[model samples]
Target: MSFLFNTYALARPALFSLDAESAHELTLKSLQKAYDCSLTRGMMASRPELPASLMGLALRNPVGLAAGLDKNGAHIDALGNLGFGFVEVGTVTPLAQPGNPKPRMFRLPQKQALINRLGFNNLGLQAFIANVRKSQWRERGGILGLNIGKNAVTPIERAIDDYLLGLEGVYPHADYITVNISSPNTQNLRTLQGQDELTQLLQPLQEKRKALADRHGRHVPMAVKIAPDLSTGQVDIIADLLPRYGIDGVIATNTTLSRDAVKGLAHGEEAGGLSGPPVHELSLQVIARLREQLGASYPIIGVGGIVSGRQAKEKIDAGANAIQLYTGLIYRGPALIAECVQALKR
Candidate 1:
């Protein structure tokens, strides 16, 4: 086992004893602490090869730390040490808004799942970008994908304004930008996934990207993150529109509103997106559906419920080009990243 895995194993019990959100905060704090102390500096510098080339960006491996884990990009340098091929941070909006009240995040240990309605709570794009620029990881070739969203108070009609602002703010810092329109927590956010709305949203962004690409002399690709709750028809519509809109990639899913697998469990009825093991098969189905529609060459970053090495390989085998993690880190900690990298390399 890797040294980091052993360390996390020792702390796992205590972490599990705390409230889910509290444990999450504590974990992020510890990562920042280790980073500040320079204790993890040389840890994964000799990482074994798990090469991936996605959307014109080079990645050391196919395992990525999903956006919500490092919401404000505050821990990229620390997370980078955990050995992710890429670390995507944020669901940042044009303006910062305190998300749904506390107790917003819940853990369902029995199902090895979690339900959260954090509502895109983040440090806003400016602070998010500042945090990204402060990190040395990107300069050292670490891949960073910034996930952008609209603020809760923003009217649905004006959502594009926020995303456009986020694209502008994060374009230079991000190797790729993810236009997040699938989070169930934000009011009306998921509605943007509809055909007419998606076209309207993506078209403007594409135009802006063209201008940004010219101005910066860099083309930072954009990926659209979708929801697992989508019908096969919805997924197909998205698949057809992606390449047409000039979207660079697609993240197979965000968390789901479906509680099919976690029914009868505590917190099962909680009003939030469900993630972890329960969503595994559902996400895989989305990938299969998306791959059928998107065809082989389009990049698909699979996320939601990827908890082990076997599942990691299973996702790729099911047609995902790469895999990302969030809740799994909470359950298995740093070890999960190494396990996934090892699995994919096989």
Candidate 2:
């Protein structure tokens, strides 16, 4: 583990020199090559077996790789080797759409933050599913989640159609599915978080989930990913709606539109969601609010700005039953996973 950590430390300068998106691509490709050579097996073996339960699924640990990291499910086996109890992919849309324009992703190294308006830019559902099906991680008993969202061209009124299609397509393949209504990159997408709009969305989703469960003879849990910019009242409203609509879990935050924390830092004024350490407190607040409203037992997959094991433990103390990582992986590398697992274990 120390060697892996040292390796990433040595490579960090090169990864950082490139643009964020290009570096992202290079990292994924490198992980794929490592997996192909079976170099990842040792990393997997060194991971602790800290069994946990969340939304009725048994997890090898409570640490998970969050969505948006592998949006097309192309790198599940490679990422799973990094010691996540589960891996989630996609914010994939029903149809393939080129996301936001170039320079869509920016890094704020000063703050250990990133601002991306990638707009669910993915290879569409068909290709996403194909890649998912090609992965060996699921057969290895790792929990995999498929996150669903609407396309860029799809108007908000018709967004339900896209989510329905996503649920149906990813159902048989996923151990769980996440309904992503909270990405800041998509226009009007966060409006789905409102009470009336949320009601309209969740009702049909629960109905569809029931039908899918019956047909597949298995009940796959659905979690809603929410934004960190929400008010206490807004959080409470969502907390009330989730269980009423039979949603299984809540990923406490996506990212924050608020740049208050990153002010004066480079890329701090970018027009996209700000993630990493900047949003950690906001995520914690949302988690605390959700736990207060939803009660102690309701599962919350806490996310946003986790960059360390102490921060990971802070999330768990804040009301997260399980936690996921994204920016942290960028800043801390694979060692953060073991550090987090150890923290939670302690």
Candidate with best TM-score: 2
RMSD of 1: 1.3
Cα deviation at 242, candidate 2, in Å, is: 0.6
Candidate 1 lDDT, 1-346, residue by residue in tens:
3667777888989988998889999988987887677546555333546888988788899899888988888888888877789989998998888899989899998877899999988878788888988998889888989999999999999999988898998888888999999999999999999999999999999999999999999898999999989998999999999999999899978999988888898889999999998888988999999889888899999998988999999899989999999988888877888788888877
* Superposed model 1: Cα runs more than 4 Å off: 43-46
How many Å off is the CA of 144 in candidate 1? 0.6
Runs in model 2 with CA error above 4 Å? 39-45
What tens-digit string does per-residue lDDT give for candidate 2 at 36-58?
Answer: 88555564344557899999999
TM values, all candidates:
0.97, 0.98
lDDT, each prediction: 0.88, 0.92
**How many clashing residue pairs appear in each of the predictions shown?**
0, 0
Task: Output the lDDT of residue 83, model 1.
Answer: 79
Model 1 clash pairs are none
